[model samples]
Target: MAIYLVGDIQGCYDSLCVLLDMAAFNPQHDHLYVTGDLVARGPDSLATLRFMQELGEHGHTVLGNHDLHLLAVAKGIMRPKARDKIRAILDAPDREKLLQWLRHQPLLIHNETKNETASGFVITHAGIPPHWTVREAKQSARDVEAILHSDRYLWLLQNMYSDEPSMWSSSLEGIEYYRYTINAFTRMRFLTMSGNLDMACKLSPDKMSDENLVPWFAAKRRETIKETIIFGHWAALGGIFQNNFLGLDTGCVWGGSLTMVRWEDGQKFNLSCPV
Candidate 1:
């Protein structure tokens, strides 16, 4: 009974299958915790979504920025970009079922195993904001999640895109608050030393020329610093392991390897993207 935490699949269904095979994954006995971007930008969005949905209780995914974008596009709130290869998913026979499953997925997942030796891990598409404690991050996720599942979900999908309120504030209210929370959990990668999100910086940490900007995990006074956090979204960082943070987005869709890690033993498995 192993638990595998996987990086961004991003619609690379064949790569996912290869990695699962290499890990000898048994859906009946093993569990998969995917760090989002389950669809878009790869060769097989429809197959990827279908496979994840079929996993049922054995698998679950945190919502990435691309996942949210899919919802928005499906709902006619946003148009698909030229680079987005999600039309197959939108046109699939089970498109509604797949999208519904994705919409219901959580923005944050806290896994506290019963085993005394297992360390608890929080999985999110992107890293949590430095100002948020684990509890606060969970609460913020719930706030947006509730809306995503509610009748007014279309409203959220329509209004969720924005870069304002770049810093966390307890007083943030309404759609502004939800947008900020969503960005932090899905699109955030770098932050200024002052704790404001550097939305424009998407390069790997070493490549960035801005001395004032730092990765979210490197921010000082982060409340979730004591807990282990597993996230994807930043493919530029590849498989970064720093302190209590583990980054698993190895850019599989961009010709890198698909990576997965077993939580109990910390053993990693990778499958190179097909040429």
Candidate 2:
């Protein structure tokens, strides 16, 4: 039974299937863990969500920013952007079922099975904030996930769109807590010199014009983390593998290849996007 970790599909169903086939994934036995952004921006948001739903126990995904936005749009909290391409999902007969499943997904996945280089791995839509240890991240994610999976979820989806409280604080509560948790888990990329989230910068590290900003993984950590961090929100990274960190959003919707990594042996598979 192999375990595979895939980058953002973003509705590129054909590319995802091809990449999985190239890796010879057998859903009957092998598990497929996605780094989120399962739908949006590509041609088949409806089909992509359906496929992931069908995967059932074989598939797992964290929630991406786009996934959260889809929920908000479906709930009439916001209108979909013209470029979103998620109308199919909103119009689907099983839209409620699909979005419910997505909403119930967590902001982080942690596996404790030991590997040679690290204790295990944790997957998030974006890289973990440098200020939190793995245990702290797990608790933070659970706190947000509890709200996301509860009746107050609409409130969470509505209030989750802000960019304030750029840094973590123990005293933060209510909307500040939820917003910061969502941003750090889904939209984070760079950190300012003072270790606050630089939410406005989406450029890759080398392309970043601000010398004071560094990728979240590069920022000084609150403590040394022993687990590998896997994330996929930064397509500009073009797939990064360094030390214990792996960034796998290769921009399949933007003409780059879809990517997958076999968790046991660390072998990677890529299929060029035909979308």
Candidate 3:
């Protein structure tokens, strides 16, 4: 079966469908995996969420920062942003079921098989820290996933925002814990040249300095996973990157093209957003 790893959809539903058709995906046989951020920023978030929910059974996805925020705001756990365009999903007749599936999505997906290209794919929404062993990273993710999918998930989502450590830690608590985990899984872009999270840097390459910040995938310990890691959430960084990590976010909301990667050969493709 062909496995296609895609970038952040970001509510670009039509674009995603276009890419899927281009790939000629066979849902009954082939597989598709996404890097998350399935909703928000662009139009058609409701359609995007519903589509992903239908595929989540056969596809793999890690919860993106925006995806979590959608859940938070929907449940009144967090207030909706001024510019968010998620009302369709929130008011939908199937909103509860769709959001529940999204919230239950995992934070990481590792190809458990032993093959080279076909197996050993580690997919996440953002990127895991350089210090975390593969086992540790997966375990930490499991911890967060449990809460995100649990009966008390709304409680955690209600209080899930902070900027405490800005790095990985085995012992973190409260908002700090959820915050760091979320950042690592979503907002991570650059790391200090000396190997630390650089949370303040968000420029699109040109404005970044070589003194302290490096893209997380370029940092040390990226090879610890020993496989391909496909992810999105880094529109500024754009498509493809260091090691086996494939970045699929093409910033379709920012007037960029929507993108997807075919794992059978790691081929990338883009579809323009309809204006």
lDDT of each: 0.91, 0.90, 0.79
Displacement of residue 5 (Cα, Å) in model 3 is 0.9
lDDT by residue (1-275, candidate 2, tens digit) is 88899999999988888888888999999999999999889888898899888999999999999999999999999999777999888888898999889899999999888757435889999989988999899999999999988999989888887789998899999989889999999999998889888888778788878888988898878798878899999999999899889888999999988899998888999888964
Give the total clashing residue pairs for model 1: 0
Per-residue lDDT tens digits of candidate 3, residues 89-154? 888999889977888788888876655546577888888778776787788788888887789787
lDDT string for model 1 (208-252, tens) is 998999998888765445668999999999888767899999999
Best by lDDT: 1
TM-score of each: 0.97, 0.97, 0.92
40, model 3: CA deviation in Å? Answer: 0.3
Superposing all C-alpha atoms, what RMSD in Å does each candidate have to the true structure?
1.1, 1.2, 2.0
Candidate 3 Cα misplacement greater than 4 A, ranges: 114-119, 193-195
Q: Would you list the clashing residue pairs of candidate 3? A: 193-212
- The 10 consecutive residues of candidate 2 with the worst lDDT sum are 111-120
